[model samples]
Target: MQTPTPSPGQAVLAQVLAMLQPLVVWLLRSGVGYTELTAALKPVFLEAARAELARIGGKQTDSAVSLLSGVHRKDVRAFGQTARAVDVRAQLGKPTPASQVMTRWLASDWPDSLPFSGLERSFEALARAVSKDMHPRALLLELVRLGVVLEEEGQVRLCRQAFVPNPSLEESRRLLAGSVADHIEAGVHNLSASDGKTYLEQSVFADGLSPASVQQLEQLANSLWRDVLAAMVQAAVPLCEQDEPAGGNQRIRLGMFCLSAPMELNAPNNNPPDGDGDAPHAKDTR
Candidate 1:
């Protein structure tokens, strides 16, 4: 018997698995076991099944949900029953202590550098201002370890200009899951949308750049995004405080990220001539 050719759906599923494998690894490292993952996944499947079935004008019965989700009917009902509690828990991310300190630090004004021992407007004061519960010394040590602050001459100075103080793998995965999911949501909406207006998805791509130039590009992107984020926070604060009319309030995720990866040898490559009529091989893929 001849082997069947791969379909487009198979290709898409393969790509999704490729993307999901890393997230699964991160989840495993973060102490989410396979059982926990399966339990967590059941709710997601039930939700998607219900939505799709409803969109198709079908009754969202337990059996129907089970059929659509490929989960047992009892499991589907259990997922639906537990969805509210899960949502409430999801709303509260249980932010790490270190992240809370960083958020509060960036919210307030501080000197470029401050002496650690000063009674007023000192590093200790700043840390206390961020969190009275955590010891200032502990906060200082954490900040230094995370490379968010520089310690020298009995003074501590801010290092990172953005919210990513710790830059831990777990934190990265958290952001990755959220932001990428939101992006995919927008993309899916646009896929079937009648109007041509698209979500704010854009990127700059270039290949054959020197390592120095890539570093320069990274710096440029970081600087611009920092300014943009500051402006967003400053401008959005008052607007966010205003009471909503009848329509209700809105939540948003306006974010910018900088990513760079070396081109892979096995990856597909297409050479396009630059303005100066040079066909340099490019390796970067977005």
Candidate 2:
């Protein structure tokens, strides 16, 4: 006995059903409602199947063919089951009645009771606390003395110009030594203490460099600060925010976050040009 071949119309119907099966499964898994799934899929598949029937020289008026014009029958049944399961859990996850999600968030250790507090405030408070041996309150006083902290609406903040330094001539000399060593390694042997001071003066006096370069340097500095600050804030802020706390690990995460990038990318490279007029290759800073 020979197996019977399916008609062109039957073959088109089978292809349409196969194409729609995965979409049906996705809708069920995504928790679409049974009524909604049926309503949405019926119109889409019916039109597609009708077009398929027309292409295969079949009559749309035939009842047997029209029955296959809707979404896959097996998917319709599975959608009902999946929708029921999701609906049962909808109330539990819904944000309407003050969700348990907040409860879980509050239960976990964040900086304070108000979970939606501004991140800047948390960061400023953490920076102040990490700076000195005193309490957060006392550190604020010290910061004010150093002309870095400011008061606004009873809240403390770091001043905008706090990142700038007024390094004395002596301290500048010491800092320049290390910077010179770095330049030497990069084949920029001409840099001296005078050259470092000249660069610093240019940076200080000029109407600021290009915004793109400044923004790039600021972002890089902030990124490095964030890594160090995050660990310090996690260990320190909770203790400070608490009314009373033990005193054990109380040290500033050693560097100032407000300072500018230690190395200036905008500064002209002073290295001697190679025979080909290309810049000398430098060792990786990292």
User: Candidate 2 — worst ten consecutive residues by lDDT sum?
Assistant: 95-104
Task: Residues 152-221, candidate 1: write the lDDT tens digits.
Answer: 9998887756445233655655655666677666766776566687787656677667679889989999
Q: What TM-score does structure 1 among the candidates reach? A: 0.64
Q: Candidate 2 on 174-242: residue-level lDDT in tens?
A: 333344333332332233233443221111222224557667767877676656556654555466556
In model 1, the Cα lDDT at residue 251 comes to 63
lDDT of each: 0.68, 0.44
Q: At residue 266, give the lDDT of candidate 2.
A: 31
Candidate 1 whole-model C-alpha lDDT, 0 to 1: 0.68
> How many pairs in model 1 have backbone atoms within 3 A of each other, for residues 3 or more apart or on separate chains, i.e. clashes?
0
Q: State residue 25's C-alpha deviation in candidate 2, in Å.
A: 73
Best model number under lDDT: 1
RMSD of each: 6.3, 26.2
Best by TM-score: 1
